[model samples]
Target: MKLAVVGGGSTYTPELIDGFARLRDTLPVEELVLVDPAAERLELVGGLARRIFARQGHGGRIVTTSDLDAGIEGADAVLLQLRVGGQAAREQDETWPLECGCVGQETTGAGGLAKALRTVPVVLDIAERVRRTNPGAWIIDFTNPVGIVTRALLEAGHKAVGLCNVAIGFQRKFAGMLGVAPVDVHLDHVGLNHLTWETGVRLGGPEDENVLPKLLAEHGDAVAADLRMPRDVLDRLGVVPSYYLRYYYAHDEVVREQRTKPSRAAEVAEMERELLKMYGDPELAEKPALLGKRGGAYYSEAAVDLAASLLGAGGSPYQVVNTYNKGTLPFLPDDAVIEVQAAVGKSGPHPLPVPSVDPLYAGLMANVTAYEDLALQAALHGGRDRVFRALLAHPLVGQYAYADALTDQLIAHNREHLAWA
Candidate 1:
């Protein structure tokens, strides 16, 4: 099967390439296309991709191009990982929200809404192009603000599924702590993208015994340390919240911490420079160790598994993915996209049934879902009012004064990306 990566020039591409090379048995790709408008970065990443494939003894041919239509034409699956405004825009996204005394994250709060607005239109255009070229192709989105982007794709009637490394990352972490293979550790992962919780850690299968209590009992401190949360919080909730929850559970503290540190985008920008320099080394046949620090850990594995299942190849039957709720959570609207464990196949993901959610988590999920709905509206039909309303609705930026100031800052920093601005 042929596959296309729209943002193949990204520093994250090597990790993905490494996965495609290592997991060829899972997703046997014949022609792999790297599509990016940044010709220089694309060339560097493309060269490394080919070397990784060859070093791994994979027989697939790798191609690179700037033409979106030509690159995705006739591909069985297309993965979206593009950043509409690059790291420069991301720096703004991660910094300006701090001016409002709020979290400056790329995937949530005011910054996330900015990313959603900038990303949705570009992704929609790409999806339309893909639809025109290969109507049967599955769009696997790995872009940030995935819930909003995937919702845009699905609403526009594209064949799509959103992938995040959070669930896989947790599975791997839990497996290492449990002395089991990652596949054997099934997470009862539920909630919206980036705002999820591991309600249960099952073994064998979804219906298998839940070992979450055992894990907490034994490794609560370690888990809490990893999440940067208090151990007692986990003990009280009896569930592991994704790291993103820190922005909510400790909003003021996180904002203070963020204010003290350089924006993640700035750090990533410097890292990308070093990574690109490393990618240029003809002798570098494998993904560099420094790339590990660049994040998106285990993304390759998740992408491979998702693509394989979507292509009707052998892969894990159940995996965590962002797709329509379809009543998996009674609290969420059926059309709202949610991240959860699902049985994935050629048709797409069908989220597994979840038990009644504790109001503690369900309330937050419902609140964010409503914010996301408004965020999507702002993204689709851009206006100062829509943007302000979305920011006002966010749990993190609920105050009108903060929302008003942040809305103007978001548009100001992202005027070039926002067509309406």
Candidate 2:
């Protein structure tokens, strides 16, 4: 099968290449193209990707190109991993929102809306190009603001699925704790992308066995440590919230913490510089250890499984993915994109039915879903009012005063990325 990575210049490419090398039997990528506008980084990254494949004795041809049209033409699948404005824009996204007492995050508050507005337009343009090249090709999006981007793609009628490593990462962690394979750990993971909770941690499928309570009873401290939450919170909720929930569950404290630290983007920028330098070393054949600190752990595994299943490569029948709700949550609009367990096949992901959620979780999910609606609107039709409304709808930036200030700050910091600005 052929695969194209639109942002293959990314340092994260080697991790992906490493997975491709190790799991050659699973996906059998025949031709891999790394597409990027930044030619210099692409060269370094492409070199490392080649080295990775050669070191593993994998014979797949690795191609690099600055031309998007030629790179994705006739590919079986196209993976979107591009960052619209790079780390500089992300730094602004992580810092400006904090001035309004909102969570200074790249994907959770006013910052997330800013990212959506900048990203959606570019992604749509790319998706349109992909359709022109090969209308039947599947689009696997790993871009940030995934729910919004995936929604944009689906609304435009593209065959797309959003992938995030969160669920798979959790499964791997839980598996290690249970001394089982990652595939054997099934999760009743529900809610929107980045904003989700593990309501059930089962062995095998949903009908197999529920070990959530047992996990909490014995490994609560370890699990709590991973989430950076307290054990009591896990015990109280009978569920584990994704780390992104920390922005909501502890807004004030998070804001205070963010105020004191350097922006994550800044740290990542420096790390990328080091990674690119490492990629230039001809002797370096494996993914560097420093890459783990860059986050998005186990992303390649998730991508491979999703792609293999979607391409009918014969993988698992079910996995966690970001797709339309289709009444899975009952409360969310059927068109609204949600991340949850889904049955996968050549036709694409069919979201599994999500069980009833507690009022505590349901209320937040509903609130966020409404905000996502407005966020998508602002992203599709750029205007100050749409931006203001979306921010006001967010639980974290509900106050009119904060919303007004955040809207302006978000626009000012992202003027270049926002065409309407």
Candidate 3:
């Protein structure tokens, strides 16, 4: 199949290429198209692709182009991996809104709003191209601010899927912490892009049908006690928490008192800076994966899994997916595009009904709704009312003096960006 990797110049590009090559035997790739605006990045990814193709003795055609039109033409699938902005953009996504005393984390607060504003236009432009070029291709989005991007694509009437590994990754960690195998663990989870909660988890098997929650509730304390500082806290969160989630949830009083304080965002930024310094040196860019090691295992396996499902290589069960709510979320507006269980096939993604969300869960969805609406407003209309509405709806922000002050502060600090008076 012909696969297109957008943002081909990204740091993760090599790993993705390595991932595809590793699976070439089972799922041979016939063509790869690399798309990016940066000449240097295109060259970097192209170089890696050549090496992989040579090493694997694969006969696939690798095409590199700066033109979206050329890159997307006749593609069977596309991996949307572009960052709206890189690390610099991420820093802004985290820092700008916080400067105004509003939650400033990327994919959650005002930062996500800004990201959606910038990204929506770019994403729409790509979607338009894809519609004209590869009309039938499955667009796999690995972009950040995923919820918003997916919404934008859906609004524009395109075929797309947002893929996140965090769900399965952290769930497995939680299972390990609880002394159960990953496959045996079952969890009910819901939340916006990065902010999610595990309503409950259980072990599901012939012998363990009723033992899942019991294991967690009974052994949770000891499991929490045994893990290192942050991981232990993550254990108490019910599911193994992601490194990114800790930044937001850890600061909450309940989370902190529970001894699951999150690592600071500033620390994450500094670590990123260090990595940039290392990669700035051309010497390190040429390193190879260790012998016998799978390259880009994190995403490649998922990509292969997606390919298998799309092609019906195996009679795999339908995969759950996130799509427009229609009625998936009874608590929220039917128009809301919720991430719920779904099954995918050649016909594309179909949403599964989400069971009722109780008060606590409903309240969380309400908060997310405001955040999502604010982003949509920013992306579509660039309005202050939309932004204000989002913040006011946040559980963190209330309809009192503090909320007003936060609004004024944000508007005053970033007048250029803030559309609200």
For all candidates in order, the CA lDDT equals 0.95, 0.93, 0.62
Candidate 1 residue runs with Cα over 4 Å from true position: none
Model 3 stretches with alpha carbons more than 4 Å out: 25-27, 56-59, 174-187, 200-211, 214-249, 252-297, 314-320, 353-355, 397-421
Question: Top lDDT: which candidate number?
Answer: 1
True-vs-predicted CA distance for residue 128, candidate 3, Å = 0.8
By TM-score, how accurate is candidate 2?
0.99
- lDDT tens digits, residue span 68-147, model 1: 99999999999999999899999999999999899999999999999999999999999999999999999999998999
Please report how far candidate 2 places residue 101 from its true position, in Å: 1.3
- Tens digits of per-residue lDDT for model 2, 38-78: 99999999999999999999999999999999999989999
lDDT, candidate 3, 145-206, per-residue tens: 77778877887888887766555654466677777676566555555556555555556622
- Candidate 3 collision pairs: 202-212, 203-212, 319-342, 319-343, 320-342, 321-342, 384-420
> How many clashing pairs in candidate 1?
0
- Model 2, residue 401: distance off in Å is 0.9
Best-first order by TM-score:
1, 2, 3
